[model samples]
Target: MAETGEGSRPGYSSAVELRGVGHGKREHAAASPPPPATDAAVLHSSVLDTIGEEITGDALPEGHVLTLEQIRERFGVSRTVARETMRILESMGLVRSRRRVGITVQPRASWNVYDPRVIWWRLSGPGRNAQLRSLTELRIAVEPLAAGAAARSASAAERERAVGIAATLRALGEAGDLDRFLEADIAFHTLLLQASGNEMFGALADVVAVVLQGRTQLGLMPHHPEPAALDLHEAVADAVAGGRPRDAETGMRELLAEVRHAMLPLWEPRTRKG
Candidate 1:
């Protein structure tokens, strides 16, 4: 995994900060409290997010052992906070805790990759390029199928909304309004997945949304999205509106193909000095 550097997102570079989101949603861990309600809760969230990112970013590599006392000292938190942080990480499979052996960082394979915080950490850190590639590939596989399904079964209102979002995407992309463009882009995918009428596909809406926002936050998105890609967004939406499953599927695949073309180089292996 690559370590975050100058081009990294805001909270990612700081090593200890909360990451707000682009999509009006707060991407906190499932185990976390709602909005860090209390002072102690804020402390716990801060500690958990910081240590979680360190482990995800490979700063704390596999087999790195840590003690509750060490965490308490390093983060200036109470032993209660330190213990809870490690306990959450252990439950997420990012670490293992033993009575006397201490908390040990586990390998990537041991991580609960589906956890949204893990996904956010990986995408925001040096592992960004890799996570984007993996997530994009997943989008390529799932979104097309979702588009086709939506074409077949989407409610009349959903079909109309898809068209409107697609129109918004094109306008924002052309006008260089990336912020609005990103929101519209999120709407485009979110609507398609939910409208797909498949529970499994609908469940992945967050995963897709995270990667979309991550791309922009990481500086991978261009000043303006390519015109061809914008056209395909419309194509998929129109296909869904027209009730053409095959067209929706094909259009989505072609759209994602352009995404892969634009993003592939970011994930290519590069020589790094230790």
Candidate 2:
């Protein structure tokens, strides 16, 4: 789910050796037996995630190159651990490993942007505002249509389930229980999309889930959700349950409009920075 991109050019700086990695720790490993496979796996994940974060967060910009030896030395990991990390990264389009070039960060445009972990890294990085706006725009474009389709196509049990989840969402939101609210919120979105019987919309539930969770994780959402937003959710659910496609679409649109309003401040700085 991690991704990377960028290459060395006139304006680009190529980091030959990583800052906290690509260094030495020979004696320590020499003193102890190699770790178990499980420990090795843990080591691999730690190294992978650290490097992944750096790549996506731009700590290691595109065109930066690191060697297997550098990674092993820097992370105090084995050559196998280092190799496997880069291998996974390459698969994610974050980096490319070659015999002579070492591991080179790719361009941003080359990243696996659809991968949720990639989305998380971007959202967790300095470029989060742009990612948030892009994902929300996607949700706005898809969710309303999904809602309408759910109203028309969903089974009776599915429709009732939507209303139930919305009711649960209302209770959790009013109680200021953000954690439960987030799960219920994800459930509501996921169910509606799935019940729409559209495979494409269903697949995007992950995207919507990430956006909802990221909003809470970033402290962007309030301790208590807006009353009107909660009402709109209920309205959408009710419309779906009642089989009113137009009302379902309108209610969903209104709910996302509130989301857009809430995110206005976050997006404002991107405009100014541009």
Q: Pick the candidate with the highest TM-score.
A: 1
Per-candidate TM vs. native?
A: 0.81, 0.78
lDDT agreement with native, every candidate: 0.78, 0.76
lDDT tens digits, residue span 114-146, model 1:
776788788767757777888899999999999
Global fold similarity of model 1 (TM-score): 0.81
Error of 2 at 155 (Å): 3.1
lDDT of 1: 0.78
Model 2: lDDT equals 0.76
Question: How much is the lDDT of residue 29 in candidate 2?
Answer: 24
